[model samples]
Target: MSTCVYVQLRCRPGTTYDVAEAITLKEIHSELYSTSGDFDLLMKLYIPTGEDVGKYINDHLLDVPDIERSLTTLTFKAF
Candidate 1:
């Protein structure tokens, strides 16, 4: 089974758009968007079985410059 994770990202000041664009360029996140909230952006990602979510966060999400913080929620079920 596949796993879906939702990530709320807080971007560095004035870097929201840049960070969103960069994440889009990476093409790893399933869905990404800039939003108006406590968090600057939101992203959804999918990982195959046995894959480490932390590794993907560190290697792909964390690697993006100007990203300040992230909150992740793993989905248990979907309709």
Candidate 2:
């Protein structure tokens, strides 16, 4: 089964839009949004079945340059 995760990203000053565009170009996230908080961008993604969640995220999402930090929340159940 696919794993659903929400990732919160912190970007370098003046680079949030660049980071967002880079991430969007990757075509990996199910949805992406700009938020007000410790983090700048929030993304919801489905980790494909049989893939290692950590590795998948590291390779695909976290690779975006100018992203200063990331917090990943894994979902255990829908309700």
Candidate 3:
């Protein structure tokens, strides 16, 4: 089973596009979207079972340039 997570990204001013591009280059996210509100982007990630969620996010998403902050939400039971 995979661990599903939703991550909200807060990027530096005018850098949302750059952040999105960086994310695409990583090729780890299942889905990503631009949004309004406290966060600038919404991303859905699927972490392989036994993978460290925090570390995966850190290396794949948080480490990307232009990402100022991130909020991660874990999901259980779809439905």
**Steric collisions counted per model:** 0, 0, 0
Backbone collision tally, model 3:
0
Name the 10 consecutive residues with the lowest summed lDDT in model 3. 59-68
Better of 2 and 3 by lDDT: 2
Better of 1 and 2 by lDDT: 2
Give the winner by lDDT: 2
Angstrom error at residue 34, model 3: 0.1
lDDT of 2 at 30: 96
Per-residue alpha-carbon lDDT of candidate 1 for residues 1-79, written as tens digits (9 for 90 to 100): 8789999999999999899889999888888877888999999999868889888788878999998899999888756
For candidate 3, list the clashing residue pairs, or say none: none
How far off is model 3, as Cα RMSD? 1.1
TM-score of every candidate? 0.90, 0.95, 0.94
Q: Whose TM-score is higher: candidate 2's or candidate 3's? A: 2
Clashes of 2: 0
Off by over 4 Å in 2: none
How would you encode candidate 2's per-residue C-alpha lDDT over 12-72 as one tens digit per residue? Answer: 9999999999999999999999999899999999999999999999999887899999999
